[model samples]
Target chain A: MLSLFATDFIENSLMKFIQTSGLMAIFSEGGYKYVIMICISLLLLYLAIKHKFEPLLLLPIAFGMLLTNLPGANMFHAELFAGGHVHWDIFVGKAGLIDYLYLGVKLGIYPCLIFVGVGAMTDFGPLIANPKSFLLGAAAQLGIFLTFIGAIALGFTPAEAASIGIIGGADGPTSIFLTSKLAPDLLGPIAIAAYSYMALVPVIQPPIMRALTTKKERMIKMSQLRQVSKTEKIIFPLVITIIISLLLPDAAPLIGCLMLGNLMKECGVVDRLSKTVQNELMNIVVIFLGISVGATATAASFLNPRTLGILALGIIAFGCGTAGGVLLAKFMNLFLKDGKKINPLIGSAGVSAVPMAARVSQTVGQKDNPSNFLLMHAMGPNVAGVVGSAVAAGILLCMLG
Target chain B: MTLFVIDYPLPWSNILLIALFGIAIVFVVLVVLVYIMRLFGYVFTRKHKVTNTKAPLAISEEEVVAIVTALRLYNSALHDKESDMLTINRITRMYSPWNSKIHGLTQMPEHHNK
Candidate 1:
């Protein structure tokens, strides 16, 4: 009995044989990763339904997460793909039936296509109407840079730190684009953190906004916006495209595609193309992008010590962004004398989750005054956050890549 | 990164240098963009203010007094407006949840006041 406690395993031939067998080998290698990924999926589901955060994204993301994490989950992995790439194509009659279609993300197609759809849906009128909103947008990104430094200080390489930092964008498409370019291995955890925190924005941002501003400031009424003319609306995206492309040529393709889509949408004459981009094209890309991204959550690639670090840093990035925007708005308010004050809640909308950040802004503002309506006003900074994050992404690509 | 993963290397120092460089770059760019934007906003804002202040006095005192009189008339009507007991008795016959004493007590004031 004493010998059994510390004996060499080979001496127990039957137990040793089982350990070496196919079924047990597969189970031992993959079981823990599957379990942990499943737990994370369940947590996302709980947040989506119970807390009702970014439910549309969380629900699909959680479902895709469940699809990819299960051992031998053929939901994504197929005959064509292995590791993370597609190799030789079958030229013969009897071809491989299975296909691991990782091309959606690996080729870097879905994220850019998603950006086009986002551009089509976005209204740049707010940013153009009040260019100062760009400051809040820029301030919102302090978290990403701060987190990059923190990740590097904690021993992640610069590329790894950059990939991790992009999650703070609160823009999943940008995060995916940067991660695909910078650190493909970290895609799964980085994406999971980005989308998860975006869903938690309602929870995370309100507290930050509350902590930073007083009830009086929250209740401050903003003046009404002048109705943006159709001609100005049509011109805005073109001007932005030129400005951004001239500054960072690396961002040209993305900014160009996005602004082109927006141009089609705003141009009064192209209803057919706009409808297709907004509806059919957008839906197909979102579904493919969601599941394919989910497919990257295989246990072996996802479960690492660094994953824990990425998760912890992600929250820091999000919180810092919120603080930066609020603080910047307060700083600007120094000169705008009299009763006028920039509602600090609008600062959180600068993180670029668009309507989610806007809704969070509106919700926080409502807490101070039931009559205060900030939804439309907050949208200016919200859209600016998208542009700001893209510019920041371009800057990183230039400096690091 | 490759050096640290393989042979012994001072990866920490490299990372520190990269981080500081990134911070300085991002800070300088953001600060300048912010400053220029504020300056432009201020200049345009001052011009807009002068233009706005110069607008005609078209919204005269008579309009204010007329709007106030109309609001007073509506307020008096709403203050006296109420449903009869017969209308309340008819609703009680249609719904059973309205029979709950706790819920009924809370809602009674709103319906009566209205």
Candidate 2:
């Protein structure tokens, strides 16, 4: 009688409240391996907090990871890809509320939405002020190419190579954008690699930046930007959208969505929409995205050697892109009229890591010579890098998929 | 009967699909990279420059490059300084509070306070 009572305590209606009927049925394969991934996420969270890496994102991601791992913790049913996001017990075959939240991430909705916020917050003024920084953006993409080659050599198919190579760009939305459309199954690892590398931007970019530039080059100071007209500022996004749309129709969805958000902000007439996209929309999407993405990390899928390789290669891709951008800048300097000296350190800003790459450029420049500041100037290339990588991703999708 | 229940290893078709997915991502990253490089190259080689920090209010090539570097940070788009004031960040020298706008621009180390 006492044993029966203990069993009842272990399995009671109270447990039913926490876990939905749908979760009670399914046989979760690879029990122990799954636990390891949960541990990995815990480690990442601890490292993020302890080392003070991107705490804002890492902490949330860690929490999401933790919630996803506990048995019957159906906070979100994790079938976000199918549109019905509710926690469900596979055993009893009943879905719950947790699945609803997973819908946003599984469908690859959140990152794109965050882009709207990013688009709103972005200022193309510096790029317009200088316009030349776009080259650095192009240069930063060099790592993607080198990484692609490496991925292929490592036995990744052309498609796998492209996905892995994109981690070099350091833009999470684009990574999710491509992975979701191309390889839904690999989304979990790819997303993990992209965000992990993005959080590690400062650590990953500096050595390559310093190795490529001399103290003299780091000390190079640029002139101020010319005043841009409002009309010109307004026309810029429109012109880019038109040209890119014509160039890569397949890339239209990703580029179109990104530019549409940017256009709303730059046009200056849609202040309300831009504000919504930047604040409320971005916040809601980030929460859903973090949780859904965490659910995909089932141990069976995430524990492959390929995942490890992708992570390692991601670092290389980022470094090479930074080096590529800086080297290109230095090469350009040779042809540039006497006073035009491009700071190779700013070349690191060529990666699509956005503000982080720009910050790295500024920090490195300031450290070498406090008098030297490269933040605003790096914008020209940083935003340009974003556009460049998008076009590249679009073209690849067209050719391969 | 046992043979019918045997586990089928994950397929090459799945792997192929996975590889195709990767290609899409790299392509985007590269296109973005090249476009940025070209855009900056155009700005760097612009016909007229406004002022170089070395010389007040006059745009020199060095100043052009330096300003481009400074302006690049604007790429982050979190310009709390002018960001608070206007979405359009451009202002003519006459409108600036200081006639020596470029003079103290890099001086005083404003970001140092942060």
Candidate 3:
């Protein structure tokens, strides 16, 4: 009886040892790739915190990548969720928090919701006052189509090429929406490229803006925008929704939510709801969207030649888009009367990076002439680019989806 | 899975078609929106101008008197010290590195000196 009791004690101790060492064993099994991926995640986090490069999205994305890659964490498994497919059986287990959240991205709900928030926050007065800005906005999408051909030349599938090309639009939500639909496997690289370029707009745009336009063009000042009345503001979203929805039904979800948010803001009675959508709702969706997108970048998936290709193409796309807008503005200037000519710097704001792109225009314009106030003028094209990109996205979805 | 696979020979016809159609559609739709917006602007501004021109003649002397009386009564109902207090404060623009604190980090050096 004493010998049997001692055997039982020894067996129990062995079981405890195996259970405790399971975590350490994962490192040996996961190999050097995990180390590289973890370092990359840390690099992203450093960029976010230290340099303040899109800290709102990048910080959460970096942290999510870190949490996911930790040995034995099992928070998210990218291999199982490949090609925009989610396996519910595995997702129902203990490691399904990110998988469930990622469903919002997969179904394109998060981006559409984000559009609602953006619309609520945006002021369309400038765009309404200067309707001609829409042409510049449309011209900026030249990069998207041009990149589509370029992606095709690089041997990407048409759907995949469409997804790759939209990174040129420099609209993060639109990029994610199109990529999630057309090329789910490419979502991770495409998203990283899109957000990274967007954050670098100040660095990227100024050079192109200067190269394309002469100092005289940059310093050209325009007449003040006509005052847009409340009635025009209220009708603007409704008219846009009806026309765009009828023309491109695939855009209804994104454009519809945007118009609804704008209507809520302009209707004058739903200020509380508009405020909530602008702040709380936007923050919530951004958190889920960023983290889940980050989790998709597992070591096996991210460290590849295709990701390098995407990074290269992304910069080219942004440059092309900026150049396209600038060139179009220059072309338009050739025809317009003296009083109506535009400062070509406002053209680069046509990439739809919102206030950042607009701010770059103001900064660059002010460099040439300190008295030039280009913020409101730049905003016209900035908001117009948002609509233009959405319409472009709809065209892609209709043809490719 | 798509017909335009990466390995497939370049379908230049299809690619060009897509590019042209996409750009054309965007241009056409936006151009249409421009006309609509212009029309809306014209109609609304015309109505507004007409109303402004007609508004003065439509208001009788009695209505003007009633409006002034009501405004006076509403002003009297306010706190005594707050009534007729129109403060025009000048905003002095100071160019300081600390004023560019978008993220609210790094306090003004003046504060440290204090």
Each candidate: RMSD:
10.6, 14.7, 8.8
What tens digits encode model 3's per-residue C-alpha lDDT throughout B1-114?
432235844479988899889988988989999899888888988998999889889998799999999999999898755567688999987977667665457455455554
TM-score of 1: 0.73
Q: What does DockQ give for each predicted structure?
A: 0.12, 0.05, 0.29
Task: List clashing residue pairs in candidate 3.
Answer: none
Cα lDDT tens digits for candidate 2, A323-352: 888898898888887566777777788787
Among all windows of ten consecutive residues in candidate 1 chain A, which has the lowest summed lDDT? A91-100
Q: Flag regions of model 1 displaced more than 4 Å.
A: A1-30, A42-55, A73-100, B1-114
Per-residue CA lDDT of model 1 for A7-86, tens digit only, reads: 75556777877766544645785566677788888887898889886665666667777776665434654334444355
Show model 3 residue runs off by greater than 4 Å. Answer: A1-30, A93-95, B1-6, B55-114
Predicted model with the maximum TM-score = 3
Clash count per candidate:
4, 83, 0
Q: Which docking band does candidate 1 fall into?
A: incorrect
Clashes of 1: 4
User: Residue-wise lDDT of candidate 3 within A103-132, one digit each (tens)?
Assistant: 898889999999999999889999999998
Q: Which stretches of candidate 2 lie over 4 Å from their true place?
A: A1-30, A74-99, B1-114
Could you tell me the C-alpha RMSD of candidate 3 in Å? 8.8
